[model samples]
Target chain A: MILLFLSSGLFLGWSLGANDAANIFGTAVATRMVRFKTAAITSGFFVIAGAVLAGGGATRTLGQLGSVNAMAGAFMVALAAALAVLWMTRAGLPVSVSQAIVGGIIGWNLFTGSPTSIDSLVKIVSTWVICPLLSAVFAAGLYVLARAVTQRSRMHLLAEDAMTRAALMAVGAFGAFSLGANNISNVMGVFVSAIPASSVHLFGFLHVSSDQQLFALGGIAIAIGIFTYSYRVMITVGKGLFRLTPVTALVVILSESLVLFLFASESLEAWLISRGLPSIPLVPVSSSQAVIGAVVGIALVKGGRNLDLRLFRRIAGGWVATPIIAASIAFFGLFFLQNVFDLPVHRPVVYELSDAGIERLRERGVDDEGLAELGGVAFKSARGLTGVLREKTSLGMIDRDVVVDCARRERFVVTRKRIDTLDLKLLTVGQIRALRDITGQEFNYWWELESTLTRESDQWAMLPDTRDNHPANKKLRSNLRQLLDAFRTVDTDD
Target chain B: MANLFARTRLLESKIDEYLNHTSEVGLLFREAMKNFLDGRLDEFEERRGKVCDLENHADELRREVERQLYIETLIPESRGDVLGLLEQTDDVINHVKHALMQVSVENPDIPDELGESYLELADYGSRAVQELVMGVRAFFRNTAAVPDHAHKVAFWEKEADKVAERLKRRIFQLNIDLSHKIQLGDFVMHVDSIADQAEDVSERLSISTIKRSI
Candidate 1:
């Protein structure tokens, strides 16, 4: 049953592999610079390696887009996005998996009344435009440099040909690696929050988290897609759109690899942040778009006479079509999952007002007398609590947000030993040690532990009541509790 | 990948073979010019016939190279340049064939006073053709060396033209019949055009080489 739920995500991964892997090695294979077999093998191995090692960063951005919070909801969203991509590809449109996944996520947020994060949405949508333009600039610059070197050296034609062939293979492998690292999020990011909280030891040595396992599965699906269906796409990209010299082909591949690496590399983002520069949002962008941008860049540098605008227009049409179709599918699919199938697509999260919630509400200067009457009330989900408080009390969205601090229950008992053994993935070591200092303490409410952790970790500050909850903090707290629950020991002394 | 490069090399080999056939025409022209100067009409006819056969052979090879370039897609990036070069070089071959045919048909009575000058023009034309052949070879083998051979072709072509002009002046100054003098002048112009065609091919070879380099 659980395996069936994973099928849609696997399908998305497969289509992504089928379509996007072409962006990595299509020009090489199509131009006969590299054989299809060699391209597929290199791309398959490196893509899996990249997914297993570096696929974590982009998933964080997708999670911030909107956390679906239910396995059934995640499954439906992935299915909708996959179907949209498959349909677009079959129709011979240039579909971007990142765009489809985003649209599907937005659809879910709308269906569940979860407000979309406009800031993250704008950043991601802008990158879809920016990624290709950046690739174009990089490709043009590299092509000029490559041509100048080839001209100045005046290398023998055969020797130059050999060098170009070797360079294409090396750069193609780099492209495939970046493709897997950046795009695995489109395949399995929906399942991150719902990832099973147990670790699977491979060969009883390497500890593979459930998220990594999902990433590996998605990577394999991409590899399979590359092996089976990428050749046709490669042919189109390689020769049908524009004629490419071997050097131009290598430049295109290198430019695409660099762009993908920029978006997905956490270390690069950290370096930028350390320098007090803005960090790049770790969002999955379209590899196909990047490749096309590179091809166009080369065309522009060659004086812009060669671009097939009709073909490009058709591809651009797919970009607009993908998101709208994906959103529609997700919206209808969620409705079916919730109503017809009797599945909890949006799992109802009921919270009983606790002492900590009321105390936090009072600390934020909410009129205590009016909210006191609703002390013991149980509400289904944070939005439900906000809706009632709006009607009965003088609480605005901000005040309601503060009052809903304990809107979710925490099931973990954070004992000294439990905290010490916690396998939390997102929290830093310092935060974990601070969590450990709260020995023998039990947190039955969400706000109690959050307040205690904020006080203990001098590194973290409790958010002001007027502001919204930080997505990173929310995810960390949720992961910390799950880890504690997994290691929770029975208290016999009680 | 090596397969495509190998096929392109084969195409290049066929072009070299065609160039060799054109160079053979230049050799036959030189031999025929020697025989004509020595008053050996029979041997000149034989040499001219040989140039004709080589021209036919070179035409066949040129056709074959073009067909392979288009059909096999060998060296697709440079296929057009290769085909263009073949066409231009084929003109050099045709001039050899036509000049030799005119020599046999017109049977111009060369004045013994300008016999050595005719041979000089033939030698220059032969040298020009050789230089062009070398330039075309460098185009495929080492594109960077093409300009050097092209410059050599231009030098030999100028020398051939200078000799042809002197021969035309010597034929006109002779006390021969007016029709005979016109025939000799026509013969000299026909022979000089061979070197002129070679110089043109050399220029094209240089241009194509530059295109390929970039």
Candidate 2:
């Protein structure tokens, strides 16, 4: 059953490999600078390494966008996204899997009457525009520097060729790694919420979480796609698109890889924040758009002759059309799966304004006078609660979201059986002791369990979002999420 | 990576050796012409043999370089241009060898007044060939220097043309048999064609240099 639900995500991973691997290795293989076999093997290995190691940051962002809590719904979301990509690709329009997945998640939110986090949605949408622009800037600058070095060095032509070949291989590997790290989220992020919490011990030492295991599976699927299908796309990309010399191809690929890494690297983000600098948001961006932007950047550096306005228009059209198409597909697909197949597409989340929730809201500076009359009212969906909040209270969007989150009701009983099921390998000794201290407590909300754990031990507490504590805060959040996943129980009253 | 650079270095040296063979062929052709004009038949025959051997060796080296380039798939974008340049430069060497061989086969009885002029014409051809070799080498290392060497090749080829024309005019006015005059005139044209072949290679090198620029 788990395999059946994960099939769509695996398929999405395969398609991502088939299409995007070309953007990384196309020109090198096409120009005969690097052999196809070497390129495929190198990219395949690095991609898996990257997915297993650095894929979490972007997946967390996608979770914030809309957590697809039901396995069947997650399946439909991935299927809708894969279908949208296939449809758009057949139409010869540029499609981004990241955009399609976001749209599919939105579709699931609408179908299940869940509220999409507006902040996450805006951040992701803005990256779609900023990614390409950043790629162009990097490409232009790198091109000039590469050209100047080649000219000033006065190296023998054959020696330069050998050097360029080595550089292409190295850069292609980096590009593959970056692509896997950033884009794996689109393939398996929805399943993160759906899959139960577990950890696999490799060789009795290395602990691999359920999410990492899922990403590894997805990574293998991508590697299979590369070996079986990407050759054709790579050849076409080499010959079809802008006629790039091997050196120019190197520049374009390196620029695209840098952009992907910037968005996906948590260490880089931490380092930047530590230096009192703003950090780039970790979001998956389209490799194809990055390639196109790099090519355009080179063209602009060469005086901007023969610029294709029509292609740009098509890309812009795809940005709008792909999401809408995927959203529509997901909406209809979820309806059919629910009504026709008799599947539980969504697990209903009930919201209520109890006394404790109202007090929690009051502590957060939310005026509770307008909400006094609505106490003990149970709303079936997040949207239902949000509607009531807007009508009854003067809280803004952010405050309303906060109210909805705090009022979300769940039964969390810290029983020994549930505690035994927890992946203790993931938590510190202090955190484990804290969990044991509250082993018999019952709570009605996730925040209640969080508060108890925080009060019991400092290890479970989230520090201020300061530069020095960024990593700690991130780890604490991840630990908290795992605990919530373990303890969350269904309400039989529904 | 070390192996890649080693192969590149080996191919680079082979190309240099081939160019050196071309330059040597031109030098030997001039020496053979001078020996023939000075009535040193034995020395001329020795020089002619050496030119033939160098030309054959250069051909073998060129073929090996071309084979390595394809086998290793090195310099893929500029491979065609480099191959064309090497082949055309080989033609210049072949022209020098053929000119020397023709002088040996035809054994034209040159008048005393025309002997000096014939040696001068051979010197001009040798200079043209040397400049063309420099231009080809520059195409490999410094593209900016190719045009300068190409210009020198054209200048020497023009000089060879002048010497050939004057030698021909003097041959026609000689108080000797018309057959001998015509034969000497044919020899002048043959030696002059060597310089013409070098100029042709120089023209190709210039174009290749332009294509190689980023």
Candidate 3:
């Protein structure tokens, strides 16, 4: 029975992963902000980390699927939800995992007692509207702000590039962490609860329960989903999700996260209700919807509803269908799983340690600073070379303050580390560690020089020598010749 | 957590350092090219001197990246292509330096008819290639920003094409030797491609951009 919960979660998680992971990296991949391999690996690892660590914000809205008492209730919910998401994915639809879960729970509930968590459900639905709308407004505002700053400062594009790259990385990392804290639970919570106690393993440092294992499985399912089927969805989001600037993405994500955090708080929801606020109350709804709404808000501010209506409609449909069909199927399926199969009459589903909550435990030894840093946290790192660079470029630090800070603070402690340059991969790992993490953004630093440096350098080479007879010209030509010869060798690996 | 945090921070710094390094070189290249095409030989010389130190530093970095690119066994793993791109990009910088060096060495100006148009052509070609370079940058960067490539390339190329055509007609009408005409014509192709490559980059960018639509 416990194994069944584990397997079901594993199965469901894969589906959820397939459905949701696309939403995370789709736009980035589409924009070529990062490649599929890079995005997938980055998103995958972060999503799991987020799932196990920070997830469960607004996760309880999903606590309503005891809708049917049938033996097959759970199975039906899983199957239907999975099918809806799969079908949507096939059609290149931008569906919401949050909504799918909601719909499945509701579909089951409508037939069962239909007793839903009004407080949680209301909040979730409200977020559906608020997240996207606020995100758009936020993005629009940020874009305007960015334009104003750049124009006022008259900062060159080099300065701007340095600033934006660092900023994008930070924003992306925060989103990933928040996602783990919030969404991981959605992927893993139910199955963990379904498991009975005897087979579960508990400890001070870890809980190796069937549920926890299932969560990992769910994460894998998501990884697979992203690898195999996520490309189309990624494309849609990149081009179709929003006409984004890096700043716009930052604004939309931050706004959506803020709204989610607000609704996530029980006190805030009650206060909003008491104050008769126009916005919906504390429901953990679709973050994608929030993002979309935010994009729309920005569009209205900048371009207006004249924004492509065709793509918007297609996206919205996926958001609508995911939850409803998922709920209905879950309700009926679980009903059958229990009754028709004559499965053990386990106690009715309670909010037994939601699987999402369990994800918070992990590799341990993480401290306050780490946790804080993992969140939208910042720290200062002092260094020597940054000053060297700043002086050399004379480009303003206003754009790259964070980067400068990072360089200053994170001192590399090489203990007589005369390492092998031959093991370049090993060296790059060191380089990667020196710069930051495994996220692929750092790799692109070299790639960006094609126009900026290469063309400039080439032009320099071709220019008429002011000292017509200067020996430097001879040296430059020979140097170029050697470089060109080296280039032609193709196999020389530079 | 702080330890992992620290690792990423350190790595980020290193990456930024490398990127900034590339960017600096890029800026130098851009300035040098601009000065060269404008016949500012002195300015090109001043800038060209800065490359010795930076290129030495970059050579180390490039070699490391190339080794890694191979060791990781990445697909499209042609080092030649990478080096070719790098070399061609670098060559343009050197070419600008050399082209200016020649002008200063010979102080040779074309006949008045060709001289004006040559300067104009070089100017157009330089700006056109600059835009192409920008296009290439935007393509790789993937920000909301892209160069106003079409207009820049079209305007510059259009102008360069016009001047080159006139220069060709005049060279023949001037009754220059067939060999010299061929040499002048060859020079024109080089200049044209500079503009054309920048324009060509837009075509590449467009294809990549269309991939977004797909």
Candidate 4:
């Protein structure tokens, strides 16, 4: 029974991933700056991490309000909340998930003797009412900020790509992280209410157990959703809305995250509610709305009166229309995903990366975070300290930040073990060769080609023009710790 | 509640998938239109090639819907409505191709802005389709929900109006000969009608989504 609830929670999480993953890179994907796979893998990891870390608060709030008195009730509330939003999404309206769950909770509360806590409910409802308004106001302010900042560093970044690329990379990671923290709760919060702490476990010590299993379920479900349904939404979001410059995407994501985090906080929500103000805390709002609001804010700053009003009207209509319609369909949709037929199998995800491979990452020096994402994956997958480097060693590519993206597809770990290595980090060039003479990566063609092309005798570092160009190498989908561990041993520092 | 909730999530995913698929086709049409309007045969051929499989699958999907027929489409009226929307979805493809093919014959190098204009109309059409898809999903539960998107169809139709005006102005102001002028005028009209139909699809979609959702 516990397992059933957990899996159902996972299903919800997967759907959440599919829907909300779009929030992270919809514009970037739309503009063709990044691929959906890269966004999905990256988003999957950060969202899970965020849910496990920051997702607790939202889970608690949703669990408390939704009248999830039992495992069955939790499932119902979560399912209803998800169905309501998805129904709207399908119908083409973009209703906030937060709104649907809040509504569902209200409906459920009506049945119970909770007697409609008008005081608490009003504050929560008001947030929904006020958030978009606040978002718009904030968007207006952000537009001004964008204009001011653009003026400040206008010429410097026009030529210096290192600083610009670095900034873009940081912004992208930040956006991905924020998406995880805020959105995963939409999937797991209900399940979080029912799960007991005795059931689940994370990396040895990090025992989220059943106490936090719903969040984990939500995170994993979101991950699955990212793996399955999210690509299309990502395409629509990243590629569909408007063509975005990287800086524009950066600005929009930053603004969206800030605004969402501001709203998600319990303390802030309580404060607002106490003061007879509106707050949308503990509910699932549209990441689409927050991002779009921020984006339009950015766009208005760049091209004011010429701001595309037609696009605006159409989008506004979509937001209004998608939900009502989506709900109607989803209300019926509920009958379909469950009763009529069995669900499909979870497919293994394969990531594809375009033109810019690891060499460009090499061109820009690795930072601590970049190294961590890259190296962290390799080490985390390693065996204990007494006997290390015995498992498979593979090349986990670096990012602009130098960290390996931890969101690889189709991986499950069986046990928890800690491994630490000191020799690999301090290896000299001669020592690396002495080591590589026995154990090494099979970039042999890469080595041979680089040796043939370059005149310099001492150049061991090779940037292959077409080596990683086979349409799939843009993003590496290796085990996180394994990739990170392997990266630490690689002699890329030169 | 749990059973109902489960069904809702699945259906929403299914419908959203179809909506996304439709938009992809719309995107292809837009690309092909741009190429055709620019008289870029090579590019037109390239983008046009990508749609054959899409069109085939679209036909297949519709047939599957007809075959299954558990719940009826509220707006499609008859088999013909299904055929009409399908054809209209394909017409978006055909008109763009026809315009491009015509452009190749009359002016191998049509103005870039002409390509730009056609794409703008295509974009509006795509947006309308998306809204209609949303509305149709609404219709899945309730018919009244359709109007939410139906309202936007007018705005998109207004865009079609803008496209018509531009196509007319461009044709009227052109310095081409009478024979070529007539052919160009006919082609531009077809393009305008295409945009109009796309908007019509949105209108119908909103109606359908509303009906289904309710």
Candidate 5:
């Protein structure tokens, strides 16, 4: 059953590998600078390494957009995204898995009546534009530097060829690694919430979390896709669109890799925050768009004689068309899955402005007087509560989100069985002790359980979101989210 | 990695050696002509034999370099251009050898006044060939320098043409048989054709350099 549910995500992962691997290794293989076998093996190994190691950052951002929250719903969403990509690929239009998956999540949100976080959506959609533009800038700068070096060095032609070949291989590997890190979220991120949390001990020593295991499976699927299908795409990409010399190909790959790395690297973001610098958001971006941007960048550096405005318009059209198509497919697919197949597409969450929720909203500085009128009324969905919040109170979007979150009624019971299921290795001694102290307690909301734990132990409390405490706060939040997921009881009464 | 660089260096040296053979053929051709004009037939024959040997050696080296380039897939974008350059330059060497062989086969009796002019024509042909080799070398290392050497090749070829015309005019005015004058004129044209071949190679080198520029 687990395999059946995960098949759609694996298919999505396969398609992602088939299409995006070309952006990394196309010119090198087409030009015979690097053999296809070498490229495949190097990329396959590094992609898996990257997915297991650095995939968490982009996955977290995707989770923020919309948590699918049910296995069958995740299956339909991933299936919809995969079908959209396959249709676009057959139609010979530019398509992105990241965009399609975002649309699928939005479709799921609409069907389940979940309020999609506007802040997360805006951040993700903005990257669709910014990602390509940034790649163009990086490519242009690198081109100038490469040309200057080749000219000033006066190296023999054969020696330069040898060096360029080696550089292409090295950069191709880095590009593959970055691609795996950034785009794994698109392939397996929905399944992250649907799958139950567990950890496995490998070789009796190395600990592997459930999320890592899922990502690794997705990575293997991507590798299979690369091995089975990407060669033809790489060849076509080499012959298609812009004609790239080996050196120019190197520049394009490097620029694309850098952009993917900037968006997907958690450590880089953390390091930048530690130094008080602005950090780039971890988002999965389109590798194909990045490749096109890089090619255009080189064309511009060469005076823009080869710029094709028609092709650009077509690609932009795809960026708009792919998401809408994916969303529609997901919406209809979910309806069929629920009606015909009798599947539970969503674990419905209920909201209510109880006295405790009202007090919590007031503590958070919200004007709760208007919310008091709606107290004790159980809303069927977050959108329903949001609608009432807008009608009754003049609250802003962020505050409304806070109100909805605080008013969400999730019953978390602290029992010995649930406490035993927690990964003791991931929690501090204080946190485990606090869990033991609250073994018999029950709460009507996630935040109530969180507050009880904070009162019992400082380890359960989040630190101020300062530069020094950012990582700690992030870890605390993750730990708290895990505990919440572990102890929550499903409300089946609709 | 070191092996890759070492292989490239070896190929570079082999190409250098082939170009050297071409330049050496030009020098031997000029010396053989000088010896023939100075009435040293034995020395002329010896230099002619050496020119033939160098031409054969250059052909073998060029073939090896071409094979290595294709096998290793080096400079894929410019490989065709480089091969064309090498073959055209080799044609110049073959021209020198043919011109020398013609002089040996058609041992025409030369008037004393025309001997110095003939030597001067051979000098210009040799210089043109040398300049063309430099242009080809610059195409490989410093494309910016190729035009300079190509321009020098054209200059020397023009000088050879002028010397050939004057020698032919002087031969026609000589108090000799019409058959002999025409034969000497044919010899002068043959030697001047060597410089013409160099000019053609230089022209090709110029275009190749433009293509190779980043």
Candidate 6:
């Protein structure tokens, strides 16, 4: 059953809630301004709401890193990442699920011999660096702003205290919401490719897609984690960071929420695109890093002399180590899952060099002399296709590239009618609108249609891309127009 | 959990006890000064011993409070503030003990003309300390009243300072040895410092109250 395979993802989600929830409400709860029970309940509710609502946006970028096409593979990847997080947490070291899951996905790619998209990898790595820096900037700005407002109000001390307590709770809830939106992908993202794109009807009234159901399940697991295990971590984080003033705590939480929101908000990205401006990537970022960055921002604003530089360095060291440790665990865990447990980790994907593959190769400028002899040939994997092509022809060094492209061509299954009937429930409203705008556009292949849809889709265009304009997107549009004209002329000849 | 909570409550009460014990230092100083002015060294020593005993009791309570603050995590959120307040408040008691010890050891040659002034100075300092003690209690029980008590402490401190200045001027004009005059002046400064320290502690109490309110 899929439930068995889902256990690892659920476990990862739980750990994420246990660890990251502290970043949101730790200062308030530890300072006793907000009761722990109240903080936990509010966090549990908002985090799930956030995950169910906006969690899907960042999953596509994670899918680009590596598509673990089998449920078993996704299980092992999530398991390895979760184990890594648990171990680091027990060791009293800071670890983030975002970094661990990225490492796990990369390990799965390596184990399965899938080509890692360097573009996605670079984008993810860069965001890891930028997320914290952006948080620091936002935190510094917020700290100054909060100080000015409080000073200007000049309220009675008790009134100011009450206001600060209320603000901390409000900002903490917002931070929890942003955290769920950002980090849910790290928990449930590996299964994105494995989740079926069809909705299941429940009691003839509620229709839930596999993606939504999986996200909801992950959200619930996260909620359970927050309610059960977050208090101790909250205490540690709250006390470990410099003793936070109520105002400083509010500023740190607001800054963290803003950073996570910027990274995960599809609405903001869409607005940026509507204005013809480049949009922010919907990437799941580390909330722990963001919170630490905000605290550092406060320390800097407070003259930077009292910062626990040693603790900062240790935490920084842990950040560097988390991903590498997770990757190693995933890499080795894959072999154990596939061999020892005999699970179907990498599915057997077949590519045929039939008329379709040949036509695609010709369009790609492959030499046509010996390609006819390759008709009806089948390959079980990308390497198999490349090896067979190299053996059968005197093709030069680019033979593997051609075979890889041909294998990719085999993946396109979209048609005009299929795009017309494509499930809107599975897509954001912006994506649905983008698909509608491109209706009746002639595309011979699904890849062409998907790329066109992606370019037009506000959420997709803003996705973090390492390559400038991502060469694949540019080529898809050009090839689709050429193929459409060729189809037109051939119809006239007929 | 309830036990720990009760233990913290008990620790806070002990700290209040310490404050009460330290407050008696002012009363003891007045008593010891009376016996000293009356040439009753034996009586003064008896009361001085009582002051020392109270000081020791306060020290023990302070240590217990500090231990519980660490071990039981009493008032964890404001533990530092409580400890800082305790440490600073203890300084007033130490000043009381030192002033009394100096008077006993030095055996100041108080002229009959200055005996009433000496007693007046002691009375003024003791009253200021009592106000400070009340302010400290208010810091723990009724924060709003702390500033008022601190104001009262400032009033007594100013009165005590004026008495000290008058005593110094009269002692200098007594045709006593320059060294005796300086020693008496030193005694005057030391005794007046008790009120000054109480005012300082009350200022701290005000700040601590403000911190809690905010």
lDDT against the true structure, each candidate: 0.79, 0.87, 0.50, 0.50, 0.88, 0.77
**Top TM-score model:** 5
Which digits, one per residue and each the tens of the lDDT, describe model 3 over residues B90-150?
Answer: 4444444444444445444355557656666667767765665555454333323444665
Cα error of candidate 4 at position B171, Å: 40
Model 4 Cα shift for residue A13 (angstroms): 2.3
Residue A12 lDDT in model 2? 88
Candidate 5 lDDT, tens digit per residue, A401-455? 8888888887888888877766678899999999999998989899899999999
TM-score (C-alpha) between model 4 and the true structure = 0.43
Q: Which candidate gets the maximum lDDT versus the true structure?
A: 5
Candidate 1 ranges with C-alpha deviation above 4 Å: A308-314, A350-450, A453-494, B1-76, B79-109, B112-214
Off by over 4 Å in 6: A201-207, A351-406, A409-494, B1-195, B202-214
lDDT of 4 by residue, A291-379 (tens): 76776666565565436677667656665554344334433433343356432111112221112323433444522322223322222
TM-score of each: 0.75, 0.92, 0.51, 0.43, 0.93, 0.67
Per-chain TM-score (chain B), model 4: 0.68
| lDDT tens readout by residue for model 6, B1-214 | 3454455457667877998887788888888999999999999999989988998889899998898667743344556777877787788788878988998889888899999999999999999988888887766656667789999999999999999998999998989899999999999998998899888877777777766642
lDDT (tens digit, per residue) of candidate 3 on A55-163 = 4334434543232222234445555666666667678765566676667666655544334445456666766766676666666676577656655554333333345
Better of 1 and 6 by TM-score: 1
Candidate 4 vs candidate 6: the TM-score winner is: 6
Model 6, TM vs. native: 0.67
Question: Cα RMSD (Å) between model 1 and the true structure?
Answer: 6.9
What i-RMS does each candidate reach, in Å?
A: 4.3, 1.3, 10.5, 24.0, 1.4, 9.1
Pitting candidate 5 against candidate 6, the one with the higher DockQ is 5
| Docking class of predicted structure 2 | medium
1 or 2, which is superior by lDDT? 2
lDDT of 1 by residue, A6-87 (tens): 7888888888888899888888888776789999999999998888889988887788688777778989999999999989
